[model samples]
Target: MFKEFKEFMMRGNVLDLAVGVVIGSAFTAIVTKVVEGLITPIVSLIVVLTTGKTS
Candidate 1:
């Protein structure tokens, strides 16, 4: 059982998964920043112009 576990950990799939997870995490952060910093403001401005606030 221990040897099987060790082999599973050493497989190429595990290594690829580790690399993918690291890259995905970085890409997610960049996308989150873009949405929050740039896209959200533009969307909010459009909504406000269309709605015409009463207050």
Candidate 2:
């Protein structure tokens, strides 16, 4: 059982999974920032204009 566990940990799939997880986390942060900093402002402006809110 110990040997099987060690083999599983050393496989290429495990390494690929680790890398994918790290990159996905980084990509999520970039997407979140773009949505918050750029897209949200545009949508808010549209909403305000449609609602005729001066403030």
Candidate 3:
């Protein structure tokens, strides 16, 4: 059982999947920050300009 588990862990697909998940998580965080910092503010500015209201 232990040998089987070790073999499974050593397989390329498992390692690739782990790496993909980590990279995807990091990318998601970066994208979220960009949206909040840049896109969100731009959108808010456009809204205020069109509506002439501040909240």
lDDT of 1 at 26: 100
Most TM-score-accurate candidate: 3
**Which TM-score value belongs to model 2?**
0.75
Instruction: Summarize candidate 2's per-residue lDDT along 1-55 as a digit string, tens digits.
Output: 9999989989999989999999999999999999999999999899899998856
Q: Which of candidates 1 and 3 reaches a greater lDDT?
A: 3
RMSD (CA, Å), candidate 3 to true, equals 1.3
Question: Best-fitting candidate, measured by lDDT?
Answer: 3
Rank candidates by TM-score, best first: 3, 2, 1
Pairs in clash, predicted candidate 2 = none
Residue pairs with colliding backbones in model 3 are none
In each prediction, how many residue pairs overlap at the backbone (N, C-alpha, C within less than 3 A)? 0, 0, 0
List per-prediction Cα lDDT, in the order shown: 0.92, 0.95, 0.97
Worst 10 residues of 2 by lDDT: 46-55
What are the TM-scores, per candidate, against the unseen true structure?
0.69, 0.75, 0.85
